[model samples]
Target: MNIIHSAVKRVVKKSLIVALGCAAMLSTTAHASEKVYRLKLAETWGPNFPIFGDATKNMAAMAEKMSNGRLKIRIDSANKHKAPLGIFDMVKSGQYDMGHSGSYYWKGKVPNTLYFTSMPFGMTPAEQYAWFYHGGGMDLMEQVYAPHNLLSFPGGNSDIQMGGWFQKEINTVDDLKGLKMRIPGFAGEILAEVGAKPTNIAPGELYTSLERNTIDALEWVGPSLDLRMGFHKIAPYYYTGWHEPGSELQFLVNKRTFERLPEDLQEILRVAMRTAAYDMYTQATHASGKNWSTIQETYPDIKVKDFPPAVLKALRDANDRLLAQHAEKDEQAKAIQQSQADYLKQVRSWTNISHRAYLNSQAQ
Candidate 1:
């Protein structure tokens, strides 16, 4: 009887050992399957660039943390890549997995892309965010970029960009005629329609171009960023914004690279990009308020001006004509234009009742 009981105990112990070994093997297999994915990102901004650079770092950190090191993003700024404006082509060609740049920067390469960035006399930041997320903006954006083997996401917003710092005040429409300025995208086209010689200079060269009189005026960003660029020291006239009420930067991803990422990692990337974009907007707003206060206190000589009513009307008319010409040329352009106009019309009405009304009440 004792021998039989011992035999039964031995069999039970052996069975328990086999079950534990199987469990350990399964755990090891699951861990081994969580493969690590690393991506390279190219940014238009230089190394240590303030608000713009911060967005990329924030995105990378979030993705890494959320993914538990399974996903890693390495960013190379303009300093390293030596091609601030070439980001679109680089990512499309798969030289880099991702890129951070303004969608309007590629307007010369892809005309339809000009619509993705802020438009002249367009929606504010909040309104534009609504358009991108809730409206048909994302679908339209995908249609435009997918053919190029890339995916685009909103990188950040610079808030309402201040109109360019000017060597002289813009008193009339003629002032814009023969005016040499560094502006890009659809806004540049509008300036050309009004006889201004609009050009695009890289961000690094903007100060030198304006300082050496290579360009008579230039708009960088609002007080949030422009203050550091030292534009106020040279150009006394700082005009209010008419163009780029909501200047959104872009993130471009190689579609093939994105597709290779696991489902969990893809969602993590999307959430990280989205959160970084919103964080950038808030940072811009905060920095603008702080910097503007500093400018008012320290730089009393800086003259803030608004374009004359007549000049504004001429620019607005020119904007209408140019957009019409683009719409006439491409069905895609027409669709995007219609979508933006409709969304603006719908959202602006609510904005008028809410934000606009509230601001007016507070001012009184």
Candidate 2:
């Protein structure tokens, strides 16, 4: 009996030591793993530049919250960085750990980057979101940006943008000839193809240029943002959107910075970005609706118009030709273009049945 009791005591002693040691190891691990990661993000917007700037702030807030303050993102707006359109180069070169900008803005550096943003008469926000999350868009984006050691995610949606504020009526295709307009990206290429002189103008200069007749027309974002820009005050014509049906802004990350993060932190950042992007869409839609109501009530004389069918056909043709040229140049561009076209066909069918049908009935 004495020998058995002694053996039990020894066993208890060993178990206690093992438990204590495990506890100490766990405490040390918890301490060591709590290291904070701080990152700097550059944005292609002025300080507090409404929707665009709000997205960056929203993403940073979400990342910090999700990681319990372990991951903090510092955002530098164009006002601070003095480079509104330099977000891609800044993030790629590690001058900034991340960026908030539109994908098509990098077309000069990487031609295929244009498709990731919205195309003229392309998918709406819902359809595009489906494409990005499910229809193999994320994988295709990986292929495009991997070479640059960068990553791109949909940062936000500006919603369907206004086609432009035209000073005079565009009744026919001939109206576009020599018509100077401020339209950028692949859409600008389309405008040029349609015989319009498409130019890129900085946001700060857009109002003054339009006021001075430096531009006959300019396509900015929709009513949500345009209201504050006072475009309606100067221009009487508020045309419907065809150029940027759903412009998806982008969140770019330095590949090295992304990979070095802890697996959990990486996920935190990813979720934060995605959530913020979707949130921006909702915000934009809401703001557009509210602001449009105000614009109509305040400026009842504003002419809301659509491009003539002939003009649309010309623009559409120009867009198709451009895409064909793009596809012929690169196999990857061909694949991306095909993917978008195929996805749009599939999703638009449902959209017609759901949103279009419902809205039409309500209008009736």
Best by lDDT: 1
lDDT of 1 by residue, 1-364 (tens): 9999999999999999999999999999888657789999999999989999999999999999999999999999999999999999999999999999999999888899989989999999999999999998999999999999999999999999998999999999999999999998889999999999999999999999999999999999999999999998889999998989999999999999999998889999999999999999999999999999999999989999999999999999999999999999999999999999999999999999999999999999
**Residues 208-302, candidate 2, lDDT per residue (tens digit)?**
99999999999889988999998877888889999888899999999999999999999999999999999999999999999999988998988
Would you list the C-alpha lDDT of every candidate in the order shown? Answer: 0.95, 0.92
In model 2, where is the ten-residue run with the lowest total lDDT?
Answer: 198-207
Candidate closest to the true structure, highest TM-score: 1
Measured against the true structure, the TM-scores of the candidates, in listed sequence, are 0.94, 0.93
